[model samples]
Target: MKPVYITRTCQIANDQLVMDGVEAVLDYKEIIADPALRRRMSRIVKMGVACGLKCIEGLTPESIDAIITATGFGCLADTEKFIESIVANSERLLNPTPFIQSTFNTIGGQIALLRGIHSYNVTYAHRGLSFESALIDAAMQVNEGKKNVLLGAIDEITASSADIQRRLGMTREYELGEGANFFVLNATASGNKSAAVLDIDTRSGRLTDDKLIEWIVETANRNGIEISDLCIVANCNTATTDNIKKRLSLKNKPLQFKTCDYPTLSARALDFAINNSTANKTLIISDYQHINHSLILLGRG
Candidate 1:
């Protein structure tokens, strides 16, 4: 695999951890840079474009070869608006604007238009693995010879969707979170201090405790990463996290961030780990459910 470096990272979270408390909603005014354009765009679209712009602040948009996005729940506010419009108008009259912006690919489309980017654009909505899938695709594109890839993971939670998911027993961890995170990746190293993505692997299927160890060990071995050399950032069951820690005898315990089941935050942890530590290597382990797992290895050079 071609080596890729995470040259830039930007995160726009609804609840960014502040000294006193979390910032409930991100202020897009500074990010958008134009009041009229910001007013015309939806919340998710604004967040997406803002995060993408921040990630590639110095780089030219024309240099980007692909724009990839991942969102488990895409444009939730617009989706709810479209549904409410149908009910309010007795299914006869409807607002076409909401309906037009309520798709999974809307974020990617909006970003492309805003940047005048006509490169390869794609969005992945694979529930739990959405962000991981987007990263995988971007890394593949870089390895396939794309110069630069703008990858983003965005998810927003509206009250309606939050309540529905709550009834379905999905929001047990904490209050719903919404955020957009963007990363600019290139095959070549940016500088001596650049953070490099060593490997990214995902597994889906049932695995016993022993099988889990084998899977983890195999991935580490494949990447030639010693377990002792890793700082794991994971959001998994306590038992699973403990088991991995015990099996590997990892020097650094797994790092769990604030949000659970939020892929963008998980991706953000990669950025945090790289920036906050002097360690040469770190790993991100994600498994909201026990069955499927995504592991990302990040190394600094």
Candidate 2:
């Protein structure tokens, strides 16, 4: 597959805006100008729409060939609102805004509508594999001669959702969290960083440590990178990282990317790799609930 260079990175989390690894001032009022529209958007909507808009700030809508987004729980607050409204109003004269905003493609649709972009737009919601799937699609878009593909992943945590996940044992390793991250993919190298998506693969159900290690090595070898040369960004637990280091006989200690309950945190891990990794090849190993697993290989373009 052809390399897809990440030309720009934007993230909005914890009331902060990070662009291209640099922290900048964030004002939603500036990003979403209309006061009335801003009032109606939920937290997730604001975060996603703002992060995406910030991602393509200078580029014209015509240059953006695609808008691809991923989320595990799309617009939960809006979903709850719509459901509650159905119950409250006895399913009569229901407000359409919440229902409309609760769809999986809300963010992507909102971005396209705001920018007047009439290109390919899609959203993925495959649990922990959501971001990886979106990324795979973005890479394919770039390979097919598409330029400036805006890819984003966002998932917001709600009170009810957090309680439910805790009851389901999803919060054993890390607390529930949420954020938004966006990237612009191009076929050619961008700036001095030279970060590009080398490869991405996802798996469902239980994945053993040995199998995970084997996948990592296979991905490295397939990309012409030696196990010794790959700098691993462990998005899984510490025990898993330790096992990988010991079994692979790696020279460098794997950099542990702290995990959270957010299904799309791997997107943040990808951003961390692009900004923090100095190695020629970086591999991010991510696992969620020991049921979903993924390997993302990134390297210089």
Candidate 3:
């Protein structure tokens, strides 16, 4: 299999969006401050466009083949507001814009419209695997001869949703935050610095410790790799780390980062692995509950 090249990448956090000391393409606070739903939707569309534009170095808008997005909680603030309005006013005279924007595919549609990309646009919202699904889709498209693709993920941590997840024990103890991460991918290799996604696998059931080790070994073997070739292994939780160590007999030492942040902040691990220098490859293992949700292999081209 050929490696898909990453043209550029950008990230926006709740606190601020900065790239090498420059302000981000969109300001989160400014967008949230808008009271009107229509205006807020417009702001989101603009932000998506700005992110796409910023990620594509010198390329123009016409260069993009498609726009794809993955958002775990799509327009959560709008959803919460709509629900609150229904409750406060006894479900009478409810606005429609919030309801419209609350759909999971709204960001993708808005991005397509802004970029005039009539090509294969899609949005995936599969919990923790949301962004990974989008990445896989983008890579497949690139491998199928598409020139350039814009892939992104965005999730908002609204107050009410945070409270609900807290009660359900699905969120972290700290305050919920919002962020966006975007990337541009192409088929042609470039001299620019980028991470190559080798393989992505997803499973639905709980994996036994031995089964998890077997899965990793098989995946690596298929790609002509050995256990010692991996420089790092990133897992979703400490339990996952221990499971890999015990089952795989890996003693290279793993780095685990767990804080009172977003529960799905495992995506941050991907970001960390990509930025850091490693010997050969980095294996990213993400498990949800007892289910082995996703495994991604990443390396340089």
- What overall lDDT goes with each candidate model? 0.74, 0.92, 0.66
Q: Which stretches of candidate 1 lie over 4 Å from their true place?
A: 15-27, 33-36, 191-193, 205-209
Decoy 3 TM-score against native: 0.82
Candidate 2 colliding pairs: none
lDDT of 3 by residue, 1-301 (tens): 5778765666666445544224555654443343453365633444554454455546665778878887766777777778889999899999877788888778777666644667788888877677778888998999988877888777766667778888877664344545666777788756445678888888877777677777889888888877776755555567667777666645366666444344244445565556553655778776654443677787775
Which pairs clash in the backbone of model 1?
none
73: Cα error in model 2, Å: 1.2
Model 2 is weakest, by summed lDDT over 10 consecutive residues, at: 250-259
Worst 10 residues of 3 by lDDT: 29-38
For model 2 the TM-score comes to 0.98
Q: For residues 146-257, could you state the per-residue lDDT of candidate 1 as single tens digits?
A: 9779888888777788788789777776556677778778887774456888888877765566776787778788888887887877656566667877778877767765
